[model samples]
Target: MTPLECVELQLAAYNERNLKLFLTAFAENVRCYRLPDMVLTIDGKAALGEFYAANRFVHEGLHAKLLNRMVVGNKVIDHELIHGLGPEPMETSVVFVIEDGLIAQVFFIPAKSPS
Candidate 1:
Protein backbone atom coordinates (compact mmCIF):
# COMPACT_ATOMS: atom_id res chain seq x y z
CA MET A 1 0.00 0.00 0.00
CA THR A 2 1.02 3.61 -0.46
CA PRO A 3 2.13 5.61 2.59
CA LEU A 4 -1.15 7.50 2.63
CA GLU A 5 -3.10 4.27 2.35
CA CYS A 6 -1.12 2.77 5.21
CA VAL A 7 -1.84 5.77 7.42
CA GLU A 8 -5.53 5.70 6.54
CA LEU A 9 -5.69 2.01 7.34
CA GLN A 10 -3.99 2.61 10.68
CA LEU A 11 -6.49 5.33 11.50
CA ALA A 12 -9.37 2.97 10.79
CA ALA A 13 -7.78 0.28 12.87
CA TYR A 14 -7.38 2.70 15.77
CA ASN A 15 -11.02 3.75 15.75
CA GLU A 16 -12.15 0.16 15.43
CA ARG A 17 -9.66 -0.96 18.11
CA ASN A 18 -8.51 -3.63 15.74
CA LEU A 19 -5.11 -4.84 16.85
CA LYS A 20 -4.45 -6.95 13.80
CA LEU A 21 -4.94 -4.15 11.30
CA PHE A 22 -2.90 -1.82 13.48
CA LEU A 23 -0.05 -4.27 13.47
CA THR A 24 -0.29 -4.80 9.74
CA ALA A 25 0.46 -1.15 9.07
CA PHE A 26 3.80 -1.36 10.86
CA ALA A 27 7.03 -3.18 10.36
CA GLU A 28 8.01 -5.95 12.75
CA ASN A 29 10.64 -3.90 14.51
CA VAL A 30 9.07 -0.50 14.37
CA ARG A 31 10.07 2.32 16.70
CA CYS A 32 7.99 5.18 18.06
CA TYR A 33 9.28 8.46 19.44
CA ARG A 34 7.99 11.46 21.28
CA LEU A 35 8.94 14.57 19.35
CA PRO A 36 10.81 17.68 20.53
CA ASP A 37 12.66 15.12 22.59
CA MET A 38 12.55 12.14 20.25
CA VAL A 39 12.40 9.93 23.27
CA LEU A 40 11.62 6.32 22.53
CA THR A 41 8.07 5.54 23.56
CA ILE A 42 7.50 2.19 21.85
CA ASP A 43 9.80 -0.31 20.26
CA GLY A 44 8.91 -3.40 18.24
CA LYS A 45 5.57 -4.39 16.78
CA ALA A 46 4.61 -6.69 19.65
CA ALA A 47 5.25 -3.95 22.17
CA LEU A 48 3.23 -1.51 20.09
CA GLY A 49 0.40 -4.00 19.91
CA GLU A 50 0.42 -4.23 23.67
CA PHE A 51 0.34 -0.45 23.88
CA TYR A 52 -2.75 -0.30 21.66
CA ALA A 53 -4.45 -2.92 23.74
CA ALA A 54 -3.85 -0.87 26.84
CA ASN A 55 -4.51 2.60 25.44
CA ARG A 56 -6.13 2.79 22.00
CA PHE A 57 -9.74 2.00 22.87
CA VAL A 58 -10.38 2.97 26.44
CA HIS A 59 -13.63 4.68 25.37
CA GLU A 60 -16.25 4.00 22.75
CA GLY A 61 -15.87 7.43 21.20
CA LEU A 62 -12.16 7.10 20.58
CA HIS A 63 -11.41 8.56 17.18
CA ALA A 64 -9.17 10.90 15.23
CA LYS A 65 -9.93 13.59 12.70
CA LEU A 66 -7.31 14.56 10.19
CA LEU A 67 -6.75 18.29 10.29
CA ASN A 68 -3.90 18.19 7.79
CA ARG A 69 -1.62 15.71 6.11
CA MET A 70 1.44 16.02 3.94
CA VAL A 71 3.70 13.52 2.27
CA VAL A 72 7.36 14.33 1.78
CA GLY A 73 9.11 11.49 0.02
CA ASN A 74 8.72 8.47 2.36
CA LYS A 75 7.36 10.47 5.25
CA VAL A 76 3.72 11.21 6.06
CA ILE A 77 3.06 14.02 8.50
CA ASP A 78 -0.40 14.29 9.97
CA HIS A 79 -1.83 16.98 12.17
CA GLU A 80 -4.93 15.59 13.89
CA LEU A 81 -7.65 16.20 16.38
CA ILE A 82 -7.95 13.26 18.70
CA HIS A 83 -10.96 12.41 20.83
CA GLY A 84 -11.78 10.03 23.67
CA LEU A 85 -8.23 8.97 24.37
CA GLY A 86 -8.27 11.31 27.29
CA PRO A 87 -10.68 13.42 29.29
CA GLU A 88 -10.63 16.11 26.61
CA PRO A 89 -9.94 16.23 22.91
CA MET A 90 -6.41 17.07 21.86
CA GLU A 91 -4.56 18.26 18.81
CA THR A 92 -1.56 16.11 18.06
CA SER A 93 0.94 15.66 15.29
CA VAL A 94 2.23 12.36 14.01
CA VAL A 95 5.07 11.75 11.61
CA PHE A 96 5.15 8.37 9.91
CA VAL A 97 8.18 6.95 8.18
CA ILE A 98 7.20 4.44 5.53
CA GLU A 99 9.65 1.80 4.59
CA ASP A 100 8.84 -0.83 2.04
CA GLY A 101 5.14 -0.05 2.39
CA LEU A 102 5.09 -0.44 6.18
CA ILE A 103 5.63 2.11 8.87
CA ALA A 104 9.10 1.74 10.32
CA GLN A 105 9.16 4.71 12.61
CA VAL A 106 6.81 7.27 14.11
CA PHE A 107 7.28 10.58 15.88
CA PHE A 108 4.41 11.77 18.03
CA ILE A 109 3.90 15.27 19.42
CA PRO A 110 1.14 16.09 21.84
CA ALA A 111 -0.19 19.59 22.27
CA LYS A 112 0.82 19.92 25.88
CA SER A 113 3.83 21.19 27.73
CA PRO A 114 6.71 18.79 27.47
CA SER A 115 7.57 18.78 31.07
Candidate 2:
Protein backbone atom coordinates (compact mmCIF):
# COMPACT_ATOMS: atom_id res chain seq x y z
CA MET A 1 0.00 0.00 0.00
CA THR A 2 1.03 3.58 -0.44
CA PRO A 3 1.88 5.74 2.53
CA LEU A 4 -1.42 7.61 2.30
CA GLU A 5 -3.36 4.38 1.94
CA CYS A 6 -1.64 2.88 4.95
CA VAL A 7 -2.40 5.93 7.01
CA GLU A 8 -6.04 6.03 5.94
CA LEU A 9 -6.51 2.36 6.66
CA GLN A 10 -4.97 2.76 10.10
CA LEU A 11 -7.14 5.78 10.80
CA ALA A 12 -10.21 3.75 9.97
CA ALA A 13 -9.03 0.90 12.11
CA TYR A 14 -8.30 3.26 14.97
CA ASN A 15 -11.75 4.90 14.84
CA GLU A 16 -13.34 1.48 14.70
CA ARG A 17 -11.18 0.33 17.61
CA ASN A 18 -9.94 -2.64 15.64
CA LEU A 19 -6.62 -3.40 17.23
CA LYS A 20 -5.57 -6.11 14.82
CA LEU A 21 -6.38 -4.15 11.71
CA PHE A 22 -4.84 -1.00 13.13
CA LEU A 23 -1.55 -2.80 13.66
CA THR A 24 -1.30 -4.07 10.09
CA ALA A 25 -0.34 -0.66 8.81
CA PHE A 26 2.67 -0.47 11.05
CA ALA A 27 6.12 -2.00 10.80
CA GLU A 28 7.33 -4.45 13.47
CA ASN A 29 9.93 -1.95 14.67
CA VAL A 30 7.66 1.05 14.47
CA ARG A 31 8.51 3.98 16.70
CA CYS A 32 6.15 6.70 17.83
CA TYR A 33 7.22 10.05 19.19
CA ARG A 34 5.68 13.21 20.51
CA LEU A 35 6.80 16.18 18.43
CA PRO A 36 8.78 19.22 19.59
CA ASP A 37 10.66 17.23 22.21
CA MET A 38 10.52 14.06 20.09
CA VAL A 39 9.86 12.02 23.20
CA LEU A 40 9.42 8.35 22.45
CA THR A 41 5.89 7.31 23.32
CA ILE A 42 5.48 3.88 21.72
CA ASP A 43 8.17 1.54 20.52
CA GLY A 44 7.60 -1.51 18.32
CA LYS A 45 4.41 -3.15 17.09
CA ALA A 46 3.83 -5.11 20.32
CA ALA A 47 3.95 -1.99 22.44
CA LEU A 48 1.80 -0.17 19.90
CA GLY A 49 -0.86 -2.85 20.12
CA GLU A 50 -0.67 -2.91 23.89
CA PHE A 51 -1.00 0.84 24.16
CA TYR A 52 -4.09 0.91 21.97
CA ALA A 53 -5.68 -2.15 23.54
CA ALA A 54 -5.20 -0.98 27.10
CA ASN A 55 -5.52 2.77 26.78
CA ARG A 56 -7.53 3.60 23.67
CA PHE A 57 -9.55 0.78 22.10
CA VAL A 58 -11.56 0.26 25.29
CA HIS A 59 -13.30 3.57 24.85
CA GLU A 60 -16.48 2.88 22.90
CA GLY A 61 -16.83 6.54 22.06
CA LEU A 62 -13.33 6.90 20.72
CA HIS A 63 -13.27 8.41 17.26
CA ALA A 64 -11.09 10.65 15.13
CA LYS A 65 -12.27 13.00 12.41
CA LEU A 66 -9.84 13.81 9.68
CA LEU A 67 -9.65 17.52 9.23
CA ASN A 68 -6.99 17.55 6.53
CA ARG A 69 -4.35 15.36 4.91
CA MET A 70 -1.15 15.92 2.98
CA VAL A 71 1.33 13.61 1.37
CA VAL A 72 5.02 14.26 0.76
CA GLY A 73 7.50 11.61 -0.38
CA ASN A 74 6.98 8.59 1.89
CA LYS A 75 5.18 10.55 4.58
CA VAL A 76 1.56 11.27 5.29
CA ILE A 77 0.61 14.20 7.46
CA ASP A 78 -2.86 14.33 8.96
CA HIS A 79 -4.68 16.94 10.98
CA GLU A 80 -7.38 15.35 13.07
CA LEU A 81 -10.00 16.11 15.71
CA ILE A 82 -10.14 13.32 18.27
CA HIS A 83 -12.87 12.40 20.71
CA GLY A 84 -13.68 9.91 23.51
CA LEU A 85 -10.41 10.34 25.36
CA GLY A 86 -11.75 13.29 27.29
CA PRO A 87 -14.76 15.57 27.68
CA GLU A 88 -13.58 17.92 24.96
CA PRO A 89 -12.28 17.14 21.50
CA MET A 90 -8.56 17.26 20.88
CA GLU A 91 -6.90 18.58 17.77
CA THR A 92 -3.62 17.07 16.67
CA SER A 93 -1.28 16.66 13.72
CA VAL A 94 0.23 13.25 13.11
CA VAL A 95 3.15 12.64 10.76
CA PHE A 96 3.49 9.08 9.51
CA VAL A 97 6.67 7.89 7.84
CA ILE A 98 6.24 4.87 5.65
CA GLU A 99 8.95 2.46 4.65
CA ASP A 100 8.29 -0.51 2.39
CA GLY A 101 4.59 0.31 2.51
CA LEU A 102 4.40 0.05 6.30
CA ILE A 103 4.52 2.83 8.82
CA ALA A 104 7.95 2.90 10.46
CA GLN A 105 7.88 6.07 12.52
CA VAL A 106 5.18 8.41 13.75
CA PHE A 107 5.34 11.86 15.26
CA PHE A 108 2.34 13.35 17.02
CA ILE A 109 1.81 17.05 17.65
CA PRO A 110 -1.05 18.01 19.90
CA ALA A 111 -2.57 21.44 19.64
CA LYS A 112 -2.06 22.24 23.28
CA SER A 113 0.59 20.04 24.81
CA PRO A 114 2.31 16.69 24.63
CA SER A 115 -0.03 13.70 24.53
Q: For each candidate, what TM-score against the reference?
A: 0.94, 0.97
> Which candidate number would show the highest lDDT if scored against the true structure?
2
Model 1 lDDT per residue over 30-84, tens place: 9999989879999999999988888776678888988999999889999999998
Evaluate model 1: give its TM-score.
Answer: 0.94
lDDT of 2 by residue, 1-115 (tens): 9998999999999999999999999999999999889899999999999999999999999999999999999999999999999999999999999999999999999999743
Per model, state how many residue pairs clash: 0, 0
The prediction achieving the highest TM-score against the true structure is: 2
In model 2, which runs have C-alpha deviations exceeding 4 angstroms?
A: none
